[model samples]
Target: MKNSEEFDDSFMDNEKVVLQSIAEDLRTCLPVEAMLPSESLAVEKAQQNCKPTVHVDAFLYDEEAVDLLCEEGKMSRDYCLLCGSHRTAPLGFISHSFSALELRFLFQNVLPDLSGKMLVDVGSRLGAVLYGGCLYSSAAQLVGVEISAEFAKLQRMVMEKYDFTDRIQVIHADICTQTSLLQNADVVVMNNVFEYFLESSEQMRAWHCISQNVRKKGALLVTVPSVQEALAALQGKNGVINIHEWLEELPLDYDVYLGKDTDPESFKQIHLYRVL
Candidate 1:
């Protein structure tokens, strides 16, 4: 990873333009209805017509471009249309995507070069992490496991629209059932999936499954909450247990890269660990 001082801001300025253009194309496919009962045919047609010419390499090395893409990606979501009405309120799943700025810091500064590594995103909603990998890291493969068929389809469409099928793949299946992916992944990113998406028992099951299947010894695991917090919550319910038996926290001693408008404290919640 290069130092922040070594990077040129002009490169990011150029890439931001290309990334923003791509985002504009993706927004065309977002359904107008907030709570869609079914997939819209219009959305599909819009995606087919949207041909994103920008390549991932255009923004891969620019830190500022990450913030730009992240902001633009927010437009892809379907918002609640009836928030102010007495009969209906704005209804939709809460956004669970990580900021692109944080992702750039994680992959480019925290982890070693990912030239031949396989990066897997658990419960990948909207494929934000996958896109971050495609545009910021050199990982050989970027895989996203999503349980929702709709979300999975959306991710696939975005990948196709951007011509990223060569390095990105989305699997429409529960992460727990995808043991092969877990065991084979060199880097696994779990971004607030367990806390908001799963019940208490299911969360335990997920942790147990990952502990048993994920690559051992050297594999990296990134999570939104600290390992201590997760272990404490589990232990409080099940009595004292040794979480160290499964994973260990890796101190982030390097300087985190941030965009001009980004606050460094915003990413203090992120935690990195090494699989045991």
Candidate 2:
């Protein structure tokens, strides 16, 4: 990855402004709430009802809108902004920026008070969470583990650009199976990355691997596309576990709770925990 500190403060500020503005525009057009099912039911209610729930259009923003938004910022020419998942045809400028949404959600809940603490960013695609965490907190150490080499390189470039080489390190490794890269962090954050594991076994393996790295009495903040929320919206499976219940199922040595509630429609929830 290449680093360029040559840019003046004004230039950096402008770039930030441009990026933020683009994000804001995309959010306005493609709101997260729209993707959820119209009728909302409690977790228990949906589970007991055992009825399939109706869903709204998952992709609210058309391709044209997404394209226009990206073209203005040079984001249109590249790969997916979120996760670098794949190349989708551009609409106006309403392309899927769920990754951005994920970062913003974390900033609101977990970014504060990170300084002086060691933070491990799990599934650190493009290092968005790593950079956001550093930008928000005065954390003494920042470490990122990403499964994709391309995203790892992007993350390296991003951290270097922000002059975070001294405080942050990015590695290419899978969070589900390998985590020797970070074993002493005070905090570990996994942001909606759990779903990529594909199977329950993989998820459990990944969860165990990451939990082993956190120090006793340290903290773990996680966000998952809430299965409860999804079932609540579709299939009326409200009998499922809520965020608190979901956290309880995790094999951990600490107390966990729903830290912040965001995007109820899409069923995304943030969970915070303190290792005992």
Candidate 3:
């Protein structure tokens, strides 16, 4: 028991150091918003297509990071209701990636040993999961499929800088076209993948494609906001057939504490599933 505790403590420290380094490198490379031109345009169009809202990509800025930004006068938590008035409305923030903290919780607590397994991250903006997987799990391969060339290039730069090429691969292609990769993956991770990047119609197509291809029995699927929630929004409009036929939701323990600053609610947004 003592040995295991010691190992866990040491590992956590190492993990924090590595993730912090990655975050710093990313901050230096990207702008404060961390939205590439293509991503910003897509978000604009998607917002126009659906409900318009502010989305802060979680990979680049977690709640704590946002707090730091606010402290530094780089970001704000609320906007003024009147230009000169003190009255303000809190900004509704939406995150587009599995945050760094969430990734730690996911790999350390949620997933089983991934040695010799392949994990694919759909719409891996900034390769958060891939880097987390490389550091936190023993997954033999981590693949990220991104439609944006610019995002893909940025991720590749990080991977190369950190020497993650042996296990990490970024494919610059739409996930709707990567059925074969999905078929072979032992684990598939979607962090608002289609919903954030694709139009409602496109998201529908992407989900259907995922459902049909990610059919390897016993394969795991990790998603933010649960797959059910995602499918429900597209039920009548997008023809997202029931996912229950293909997958089963796995309950997660939410009480595990990673830090004093970690938000339990954020962790709850993560859900796990298995191919049935």
Best by lDDT: 3
Which segments of model 2 are wrong by more than 4 Å?
1-105, 176-182, 226-268
**Candidate 1's TM-score:** 0.70
Q: Write the per-residue lDDT of candidate 3 for residues 1-276, one digit (tens) a residue.
A: 433545555555676677778878888877787777767655675466433356676777767788998999988888787899998877767777677788989998888999999999998888889999999999999999988887898889989988999999999998988999999999999987776666788788888899989999999999987898988878887565777799999989988867654677888999999999
- Winner on lDDT between 1 and 3 is 3
Report the error of model 3 at residue 149, Å. Answer: 0.8
- By TM-score: ranked, best first: 3, 1, 2
User: Per model, how many backbone clashes are there?
Assistant: 0, 29, 0
Writing each residue's lDDT as its tens digit, candidate 2 over 155-186 gives 67656655779888987877754445445666
- For each candidate in turn, the TM-score is 0.70, 0.52, 0.89
The residue-by-residue lDDT of candidate 1 on 1-276, one tens digit each, is: 233444634346433354455444544555422213343432343344333111122112233443465477732213334566544332222225565566667666777788999999998766777877777778999999987787788779879888889999999997889999899999999876676456567677777777778855789998877767765667555344466777788877545545553546646667888877
Task: Quantify all predictions' global Cα lDDT against the true fold.
Answer: 0.66, 0.48, 0.84
Candidate maximizing TM-score = 3
In model 1, the Cα lDDT at residue 246 comes to 74
